[model samples]
Target: MEDIAEAAAYGVAAPSAASSGAVRRPAAAPVAAGAPPGMAAAPAAPAPPMAGGLAAAAPPSAPRTAPPAEAAPVMGGVLQKEALGLVEIVPFRGVRRTMARHMAESVAKQAQVTTMDEADVTIIKRIREKERTVAAERGVRLTYLAFAIKACTAALKRFPRLNAVLKESGEEFVLKRYYNIGIAIDTKSGLVVPNIKAADTKSIFEIAAEIVDLVDRAEQRHLGVDELHGGTFTITNYGAIGGVYATPVINYPEVAILGMGRVRELPVVHEGKVLTRLLLPLSLTFDHQLIDGAEAARFLNLVMSYLEDPDLLLLEGA
Candidate 1:
């Protein structure tokens, strides 16, 4: 019975000895009834003296390993949304040298001298006098440009081809549909023609406002790309510089350009006697490709009529 008891105890201790490679036995004597068959025995209470030495000799474990690289890349719709929301501004070099050369050549190579015409702007002048005061009260200064733009709009309706451009593709002229009126402004750098789009649709007040805004921006050297392109007709106000008349250059590709000269008091024969009246010099340069002398003369007559009877422009729903 004693030998069997010792054998059973050794069997229960086998797994612990295999796992840890250590042997332990309680100091107390073994019980006769060994642990039941096929049931795990409580581990032997370790021998006390060597237990502390075993725990202290073990090395500290390394940290856990990272996951494998085969996992998918993280993606979302936010990146695509950011790319689509960006705005782009395209900048290009301008043909300013050509424009400058043409302007200088126009002044020097004028075939015909400037023409002078006297317009009785008495009624229009009076209306301006009244409007200027009202405009001043509202912090706006009304200039003759408002009246001129309005008169030009009415005259253009009478002569639509005057607003046309001359395109020479295989010896033919192509007239365009839209009417864009360019106003020539002499900036500190040079001259620039920033046109007003759809001039016929705007009122006199609106045209005046646009001119003022554009001229202000131009002087500041802040004109945008759109302002420097696309013109069908042009007006150069040389009157501000005291020029009586000037054969202004035809802004290229356009059929006609009008020049306004200084308004001065001059002696004119009304009936038989000489009378002092306000007179303005006018010059018109037209492309011979599309406009004939007769047509040009008629267009000038229309413009003169509008200027002479500026009140008619107001009454004509300008």
Candidate 2:
């Protein structure tokens, strides 16, 4: 009774348990001397020391690894199992398989870093508007992506390091003198990047027409294998799907990848006056092993400059 009174004086839980004819439990362990009333409960008692501290631990369960059954047809890695679920189960192959493998390789091999910025594309927007009808008359659909490609290659020329690929041997970076820019196109089957060879030398209208042809052929899954190779750089415009900004993965073998976001009108201060300017979000993901943060920022700034004053591309892109 006196012990219970002393415990109650400290405002802590009293140590009580079932009396006779009731279930029993271990007594509450002692709180430390000078421990506050609401201090944490005492830790459970340690297990009894193993005999000689050398008792044998049970052997680890057999390691589970991917099956290596290749005695028959169908090369290894594909398991033929019975379907046992309500959800759909399909083989991981085809374009989706290729995409998964490449993406995994890129993430595993390269040190990818994404730098984001907004470009004031107001001037290019106006130019695109004026040329829209003209391009249609010539059987082409001029898009801002064409102008963006022009501007990007112009910037790439100045930053040759970002336009190169590190050799598979990792001994050297192969700087591509000519630009073969890959554009990622989403199709019903999967994503395919068929590059425009010598894209830097082509005019905006040419690029626009090529983009249309590539997209059409890609949708029909008719792009030639050669058309998808030999790219030095890649660009993916998630803007068509309404993305504002994103960290895009590098297209392996190439050192960098750039993503374009939707152009939206926003008010901004330009040359001492406020105006509604068309802004495009740009994401530049580069291999950090080759390009540093400052270099990436400078390269993106140059691209943004061309976007802000698109007339400059005419001088450099040609």
Candidate 3:
């Protein structure tokens, strides 16, 4: 009857003919803006029936809500099927394979411990600026890395434990008498570590020139096996690539590796005055089995001392 039809028009349960009572549908609450997550607005109700049995026009529907922010990036990997399927298989080859094996072996063999520190190198930077033209005259490109190499060699000589290697038999360790400092370089093939023979005896300018030659030869894959092996200590300058700090892995067999980060100028309290200074970040990763944390810290401090005062480097024959 009319009452039942009226109830049905509003999507409410119709009353039986025996009851014939009008049933009412409650209006759903409007969804508030910026509702908590996992909530959605209710749909608009259908229009009521008119007197002539024609239904009235329905009210406008609520706007569809956007999906949650967390669920919308690339549609939860539903749009990114490339990862789910076999995209391409490129196995390591040649130098890449060698690098992979060596890196894995180094990680498996050594118990690595990393320590971080920053050094004020404002004076060193100023010295480099003044000596840049002199270095250019000698066909040597002056760089912070050259200074770091000099500092590291001095530190290694001072803290010989850091420049030592643990024996494979686990009975004793060897402290190298000569300094063959490895300089890690990135080539097209992979990472190449070519060491400078007797790095401790070389002057800053000589080391800089050797670094250039080693890098050029390394990239060309023309370095001898002697250059690759016999590295008593290693240094990697990730600062060249803009890395601030990193827990660098040790070049296996060598007890420690020094990682240099980018130099950033920041305000510091020096001599009761707030002044900006160039600060270099350093990371030292060492084999814990061979070198203790305290020993590593002292070694890093010595390196920083030479860098902070370029005078120390000159006094040390750098």
Candidate 4:
């Protein structure tokens, strides 16, 4: 089973006959003459209407069409829509069987636990409170997830290797260049991770808006293939459902997954005196294959620092 699982991970075999049977290659469209390789032909234009007996005279300044000899060369390339239709699928061979067995044995598997310090998100809550009205005017809801996503983006920028994939072929891991942050949404059917592409470039409001739309589509099970691919890092807010300090399973392929637990009032020492503060539990599960415990702690610390004083994040963006 272990060998089969490893083989499946490397795309060596299908997970099962049923899973393998689901793989299908999309059909390609015809190419046109003079079109670039892989490019489809442009659609033909409609013919001009026939002249009538009382047709209006042409304008004096009307420009004449240039002859083909003087026409600029047409730059042709395959349309992404057409290319997407030609995607090839490799059947999952080994992982499906192991995945099924793991699902059944999940309760019995000993969880690898690691507890990080709680983050005081009072400032984050305050910012959301202050921006809720303005955000609504912009047609985007201000949520903690937006702030979390921003923090993750900034942290990943500082620590690029954290955004990597683990492969057994080499001792080294592959670090991803683009930042596509995936947010895990729980649906009635199962879990889904819809990614926000080029997340580092979006504003906090934009991130919040996209997150809301993604979650809505996920719940409705209307997400497309593009929304569910190319995740360099993942954030799962299990806290939304009232879970506290859970060791979440790593979303395979991505090196790190950040989990947020419920926020609650807790006593903490500040300015030499104990004070009650609203704190959030954050759990970061990282692939040991890509990052060590120390680096993971630092990444989590960076996120915690931003949450503690979200004003810093706002100023950084400014």
Candidate 5:
């Protein structure tokens, strides 16, 4: 029984009472220093007693085998977590690397500034609701992006500087007569922005259909290299992903980029009475070197006015 108890204390299975009482417990092995807690090896057995019951000291020539109380913060500590799992590594591809470098260079070179304002899109939403059947009959989806693109093109026409590009040599600001707006599309391959060529001439329904086609092609990685360039201005709708507002980086060679945030209903004052209004957050980031804050604010105000009353879009002959 005593031998069985001793064996049990040493983590060994105990022998049955009917078995021999001469069972012996093996000496515990020495644990290395720095091992994780609860995983350290057991200490070596104590030296046996000699003639007068004094423990015999180990020989001077014998090497010490006892582990330290704490590990030295080396291999054993690192291996402790290895018992679980490790992170997988992925290599960076050319497209993603080029995007990273371009974005970094844009930030480094451009004199960037961002201005934000919220537009009351209640009227536009109501108009879309009323025209839903007509749009469906025309086989087009009347999205906020279409309205935004329409409004943006009109604002760019009124404020051409916002749609222009600055020369790298600082020779002159080249104002573009053509209006091509780039829509930033997030795809599985990467982010691709394919602009609507001569977007100013397209109607709201036409813009909607084109947007759908461009987004589909971008996601499927079927867009041509030419479609990726020649954008005068860019617009990215972070609203689709529930983003409120973000300072989007300018596509270099283009003077500005606009970000649309998620629309939410909030109480607003109208005619001295509080009313719930659907507000769309707008963030316009531009090159501060070429455009001033006042001009940018005016451009934003124009876009907001057009959005607030979408009828002005047709009235402007846009």
Candidate 6:
């Protein structure tokens, strides 16, 4: 409270000092013509000199001048339409403004490029179909998001370049050996991405449990500052919001971000036969200055492979 008050007080002028180093008296207002002798206004005395032999100070008040007349409207005297009646301004404050600045900086600083692809998630769908019941038994909801997180972590281990940050000097890449995937959660306050640390070592069930807890707490606004930082990679699933595909902006400092779109059954050609398979749209946006288009495509392929074949994830002991 004191800090806020101090900040507000900053730039405000203090009371003018008098000759005796006391508060200066305000000049009297003008008196009426018929005022009594005692009520007559006296001429203000010249300001006294400083004790250090400086010149006399000037009067605090200056003569007031009339403001300039309003300028005439230009363009052949034509008047502009007033949209102020319909326009409304809602203040963007606190974390919302911070989020906006962060996004703007990310767009301004990185040479972003998005490469999109669709993944055949029939295998992950089948696994989730069986695990949902087991997850319910353990009091956790098994979601495709958990599977996506697992797949992303595995892919990061294989393509570690995507899991690194480029230094400001652009001389070297700071490759992070640890895998921490920030999960973008939509909360009442706004969007917040609190990452899961050491995500590569966690299993599907464990990741699902953490997802449930992190999302619950994130929505409740109980997540600490520590939970919001140190992400090696980020994943934003617009699937829940019914978006098919979007070019998600890369989270700053991190080389890349993977956007997951809504999963639906689509007719795809499978070995000379058209069959309906559950497909998930993936949009991988990366810093072109750090990773090439080919590398981004390969990274997306590895992630898709993990989702397309659940056995690989299990064989890796995830």
Which ten-residue region of model 1 has the weakest summed lDDT? Answer: 13-22
Q: What's the CA error at residue 282 for candidate 4, in Å? A: 0.2
Q: Tell me the whole-model lDDT of each prediction, alpha carbons only.
A: 0.63, 0.79, 0.79, 0.71, 0.79, 0.78
User: Which pairs clash in the backbone of model 4?
Assistant: 13-93, 14-92, 14-93, 15-92, 15-93
How does residue 200 of candidate 1 score in lDDT?
76
lDDT of 2 by residue, 1-318 (tens): 443242222222222221122222444444544557436446545555578886455546445444343332232232333457222223454565566677889999999999999999888878878888899898997677998888888999899999998887888888999999999999755677889999988888999999999998877767776787789999999999988999999889899999999889999998899998889999999999989999999999998998888778866545
RMSD of 6: 17.0
Candidate 4: regions farther than 4 A off: 1-115
**Candidate 2, position 175, lDDT:** 90
Please give the RMSD of candidate 3 to the true structure.
20.4
Q: In TM-score terms, which candidate is top?
A: 5
Ranking by TM-score: 5, 6, 3, 2, 4, 1
Clashes of 4: 5
What's the true lDDT of residue 283 in model 6? 91
Per-candidate count of clashing residue pairs (backbone under 3 Å): 0, 0, 0, 5, 2, 0
Candidate 1 per-residue lDDT, tens place, 43-84, comes to 545444456465333345355443233222122111111356
lDDT per residue for candidate 5 within 155-197, as digits (tens), equals 9988999999888887799999998899998875556678998
| Superior candidate under lDDT, 1 versus 4 | 4
Using lDDT as the yardstick, the better of models 1 and 2 is 2
In model 2, pairs of residues that clash are: none
Badly placed stretches (over 4 Å) of model 6 are 1-84
For residues 211-254, what per-residue lDDT tens digits would candidate 3 score against the true structure?
A: 99999887666777678789988999999988999998888889
lDDT of 6 by residue, 83-195 (tens): 46222223454444556677898998899999999989987778778777898998898778888899988888888889999898889999899999899988655677889
What would the TM-score be for candidate 6 when compared with the true structure?
A: 0.73
RMSD of 5: 18.1
CA error at residue 220 for candidate 1, angstroms: 0.6
Q: How close is candidate 1 to the true structure, as a TM-score?
A: 0.63
- Structural similarity to truth (TM-score) of each candidate: 0.63, 0.72, 0.73, 0.64, 0.74, 0.73
